[model samples]
Target: MFFLQMSGFPGSGKSTLAREIAKFTKAVIIDHDIVKTGLLEGLELEGQDKNIDPKRAGGVAYHIEWSLVDFYLSQGHSVILDSPCLYDVIVENGTTLAEKHSAKYKYVECVLNDIYELNNRLKNRERMITQIGPVDIPEERWQEVINRAKKPTHLECLKVDTSQHVDDYIGDVLLYIDK
Candidate 1:
């Protein structure tokens, strides 16, 4: 079994690739968007979501996602966590979880370098409440996130150029995991 951690910008197809990976491997997907959106909606009904900052919600959602991953791993199931790899804490937590469960830790980074294409994807995609609709973040912050996206240096990281169809590199990705 494997614990695959997906990393990318919002419009870079993390979820889509996660779905494809899960389909082929029967891994359970814990999508951050689904978790975060559910969190915001539940908190919204309680009138507490307005003041819920992204960082706070992200922390909570990640804790919940990690818990689920741990549970699934304990049950001898592979898991695919669909979230941006923006922080070192995320990578550390995933690595720890994988080690604990004796599963291979796989990291895949989706890249869409063209700003125009990224903006187009962001605009055309069906968005969750927590997802950005466009490239509204300040340019420097945007560049920072791109720069911050990373994988553990010691492990093999699969960088998929998502400007092309996923099918093109999916087989190689599967092989990478299988090896």
Candidate 2:
């Protein structure tokens, strides 16, 4: 099984492209935002404002995100983890998990050639539910997430600018993986 970890800023098309790749490769997509939203549902967090502790939210998201990946890998299934993973620890975890499970791993970074398009997409995206829970996050939180996104190193990952046509983007990724 191939474990794909997609990292990118919000509205950079990581989720859309991750789903596309999952469809073509028959892999499961584990998205962080979707998981966090689900986890927050019915929870009464005081001042749960977007301005709340970002680190706390990030930690929650990290735990849920990795747990899903570990579960699927244990089941001998390919998984695509989609998130704005700016931390090296998370990336290392993905690689280590793949190694320990004897599965192939690839990190795909989705970049945006046009910032405007990314902003529009983030603001207008329809809710996308997954195993986590609700998929709708507050706009302010979304903005905060994007603002904190960091680019992954290039040594062991393939970077794709999602501003290209869908066919081209997919083709490029396929070719990259094949290489």
Candidate 3:
């Protein structure tokens, strides 16, 4: 099975690209923010100590995501996950999920041109609230999370710059998947 996880900062166009990829490839897309936000609903970072930790939110995202990965892989479907998966825990979890299912996995990192565009998108974006919850991460927390986002190396991953034309970037992803 093909498992694709889109990684990038919030409002970096990962979700939009994931939708495009899913449409073209007919793959199942599992959005991380959607899950994270759902898990975040009614739950404010309440305190600056425990609740504000990005890792804490990531830990929650990891379990939910891996579970879905397992479920979809068992059904023999390719999975496309869209989220700001910039933490080692997320990458490690993705690797673990792939190993457990013996499925081929790919990581797609979305690169935005600038913070201005990203902020604009985030401010106007409408996210889906699934089983997780509604996410209302404050500006400070958003920066904190971005600063903590892990940058992937030339391991078993593919990076796509979303600032480019969609067709061009997506073509690269399709080519990578073909290989």
Candidate 4:
């Protein structure tokens, strides 16, 4: 069993790659964005915005995602966390949980450095409540955010160039996990 931690910017194809990997490995995916979006939508629907903001929703969502990860791993299922790895806390949690479950810890970082490409994808992609809307963040910050992405220092990380066809690099991920 393996716990694959996905890392990338908002429009860097983290979810797309995670889906492909899940299709092949049959791993259970606990998508952070989906959980956060659900929380935000529930609040908006119930007129409860005063109770929690998007930032808090993100925290709650990650908490839920980690719980699901631990649960699935404990049940003998491989798991994938489809989220940008931006914080040291995330790395610690993922690594510790993997060790606790005696599962291989895998990290895949989708690298998309082109701001125009990222913006175009973000602009046209299916809208999610917690997703960036039409590059709402300043373009200049995109590179900074990408540079700020975090990963485990001691693990061998698979750096996927997002411009390549998934068929090309998906095998590398599979081999990495199996290795």
lDDT of 2 at 42: 25
Give the per-residue lDDT digits (tens) of candidate 1, residues 56-170: 9989999999999999999999999999888898999999999999999999998887677889999999888899987766655665667678689899998898988989989
lDDT score for candidate 2 against the true structure: 0.73
**Tens digits of per-residue lDDT for model 4, 1-179:** 99999999888989889999999999998889899988888777888755676777888999988899999999999999999888898989999999999999999999987778888989899978679864655777776778777889998998898977788889988898888
Per-residue accuracy of model 2 over 59-144 as CA lDDT, tens digit each: 78789888888889989988998887778787778888888887787878777745567656765777543222223546546555
Residue pairs clashing in model 1 are: none
Stretches of model 2 off by over 4 angstroms after superposition: 45-52, 127-155
Q: Candidate 1: where are CA atoms >4 Å away?
A: 136-145
**Which of 2 and 3 is ahead in lDDT?**
2
Best by TM-score: 1
Q: What is the TM-score of each candidate against the true structure?
A: 0.93, 0.78, 0.74, 0.92
| Ranked by TM-score, top first | 1, 4, 2, 3
Model 3 scores a TM of 0.74
Q: Which pairs clash (backbone N, Cα, C closer than 3 Å) in model 2?
A: 38-133
Report the lDDT of model 3 for residue 142.
Answer: 60
Q: Rank the candidates by lDDT, best first.
A: 1, 4, 2, 3
Model 2 per-residue lDDT at 51: 46
What pairs collide in candidate 3? 37-133, 38-132, 38-133, 39-132, 39-133, 41-134, 86-150
lDDT of 1: 0.90
Please give the distance, in angstroms, between residue 157's alpha carbon in candidate 1 and its true position after superposition. 0.8
